[model samples]
Target: MRLFIEVPVWLGDTIMASVAVENVMTHFKGAEVVVFGSKVATEVYKAHPSVSSVEVDESKQSKNRWQWLYQKTKTLGEFDLAVSFRRQWSTRFLLWCVNARQKARYRRLDKASIHQVKRYNDFAAHVLGVALPLGDLVLPFAPHSFARPTLGLNPGATYGSAKRWYPEEFAKVAIALSSTHDIVIFGGPSEQDIALEIETLLHEAHVTNVQNLAGKTTIAQLCAYIGGLAWFITNDSGPLHVSAAYKVNTVAIFGPTMNTETHGWHNPNERIVKLDLPCQPCMKRVCPLGHHACMRGVKAKDVLDKIALLA
Candidate 1:
């Protein structure tokens, strides 16, 4: 049988949805699985053992953007099963065009509050006719090689600045940790400035072996780098969940977002640091008050202390 899967759009969401991927693969066994996703999401699934082909939606909008996209996917022919992790209308329309024999869309449980991984797993279970046990993310590779001991710092959040920790504080923490471990910074194109600022501060502090990989590596390369890290200290962002998938020791700093919903999915090595502010967990892209006390209140030492305990 042939299957088509449309994964979530965000990096973290895609990683978390791997539980469903595993379930679908298990149910179908030898079926060919084709995945549809964004560039980064495509990278996340490219190395999956069960995935046959990955189709990325790299189309930049023009006069006939939807038509172009529809035409691109039309070449896939008929699928036996199609599963979508998103509820958006565009995704629904795409699945409609795929012309699968049977289709399943993700539906949240009524009045239920759970991690996204569980939600994805539930959808897969519903489709597969069994509740599959969720497990750690299934990457194409084994646990990473640790030729050089390193610590990874992810200071930027793609959603917005509200979710990011202070860059200066990240530099301070990196400077302190650099004496014992090599530091590697991670980010996307939008976060290059924050990563570079940390690099400059580290240089001024006479710290060495700091590699600013922000905007320098692709999503696949970033996942490989994350696998090799001794510890990953990051904000509540995409890389944080990536580290969790690799089972890396990660300290996630949470501010405007709730930790329960999006924290590391059952990873024993995961640690979360957040302050209990009145307006915290605001869930805003930018702090409406402009002070950003939720993130600002967290100190570098707090993150370091959490790392110390984990070590």
Candidate 2:
């Protein structure tokens, strides 16, 4: 069967959707599946057990992007199934153009209420009949490549700054834990400053083994590095999810906007720490009141202890 899968755009979304890829492979047993998405994500999963081929959207540069799908549809040959993680109503139109024998998707009321991971999984389970029990959505990255151990320090949250635990606290944790584990901080381009600030904190503490790779490595690189870590301490962010996805032991600190169904994480060796603040988990990236109890109240020591357990 020529199956066409759409990937979720965000990093965590992409990682979570890996489970869908594994589902497709297991459901079909020996059937072949093809994936469509940002070239980056496609490449990340290209070697994965499920994906047979990657068809990058060549027409993305053109102004009429949908036309590209239609064009690609005609050229790529017919597909047996088209499943999408994309929530835009336009996805229906895109899947339709794929000329698949059948079309499937998550049970969403409409374009407005679509959650990325649910949309992807529902389509896989309901449409493709891949209702394999929910497997961890993590990617299989090789942790053995890196010779050194790391204290996976994530300083950015995809939601926004409000979800971030204080950087100074992260530095303090690094200072305390550096003697035990190398503090190898990680994040994205937007989080260079956060990583650097933590590095500065480490410097102030006269600590070593702080390698800030934010904005330096690709998603694949980040995932690989995450595998080499002894433990991870992070806020609600893509890297945190990625770390959990790799099944690396993690302590996902929550400030706001949390629930395991969506953000709490699914890895076995993991725990979440949040203050019992009434106004906590406001779910808003930026708290209305200046006092950010959901995050600010959680102490560095608690998280460090969690990391120790994982280590």
Candidate 3:
């Protein structure tokens, strides 16, 4: 059988969506699973053993998205089943193009799902009449290693500064964690400036193991090294989700995003650090409140305490 799965835009969401892929394979062992994804997503799961092949959608999926996708999926050949995690009207258009005998998609957007690792599997149950027991969307695959920081700090939040815990707070966490572990820092090319700022502070504190890997390492290599960590402390970013999927003991700091439903799929051990600010979880990419109390209120000691509990 040939199967098709339309992917989510973010890395964390893709990790969780792997659960649905697992479900499809569980019921149809011999089936060939083909994934249609945003370009970056194809790279994120490049090594996935179960995927027969991945077709990258070069066109950006956005409003008026169906006009492009309708012409795109026409090339996917005939598929036996098409299952989608997307709820947009655009999803219907892609389903229309796939030459599949059966098409399954969520009837409504379900927000209560914590990890989206399992809830994403609902498409099958709704469309195929298969009531597979519910499960979390955490991937079991190990990331490829680059350099494991005997001590690691990811001080940048890819989404925006609002999601970042104070860099000084990260430095303090590093000063403390450095007492027991070697430290290396990770961030994106855009965030090298922040990584430098934090590294300089730690350097002044005479803290060693603080090396800047921001923009230096690739995502795959970073994820590989993170999987081997004794513990990972991060803001609400893709790495946090990757580490969670890797099942590393984690303490996640949050500001604009809520910690309840989006932190870690099914890992009960994961902790999200935030204060009870009334305006929290506003869901904006940037903070509307100039002060950002929800994130600023989180202290390094509070976060370290959570890591201590894990140890």
What TM-score would candidate 2 get against the native? Answer: 0.87
Candidate 1 runs further than 4 Å off: 59-62, 142-146
What number of clashing residue pairs does each candidate have, in the order they appear?
0, 0, 5
Query: Each prediction's TM-score against the native?
Result: 0.96, 0.87, 0.87
Which lDDT value does model 1 have at 83? 92
For model 3, state the Cα shift of residue 189 in Å. 3.0
Give Cα distance to truth, residue 83, candidate 1, Å: 0.7
Residues 1-311 of candidate 2 have per-residue lDDT tens digits of: 77778776567777767766677767776666878877656766766776788877555587988887788778767787777777766667777788878776545533544444555566677665445566676575676455555678887976688889889988888888777678788877888988899898888788867788888997678878887677788887777767777677788888776544455346787888877788865778688888887888888898877766666
Top candidate when judged by lDDT against the true structure = 1
lDDT on C-alpha atoms for all candidate structures: 0.86, 0.74, 0.75
TM-score of 1: 0.96
lDDT of 1 by residue, 177-223 (tens): 88788889899998899899999999999998888899999777888
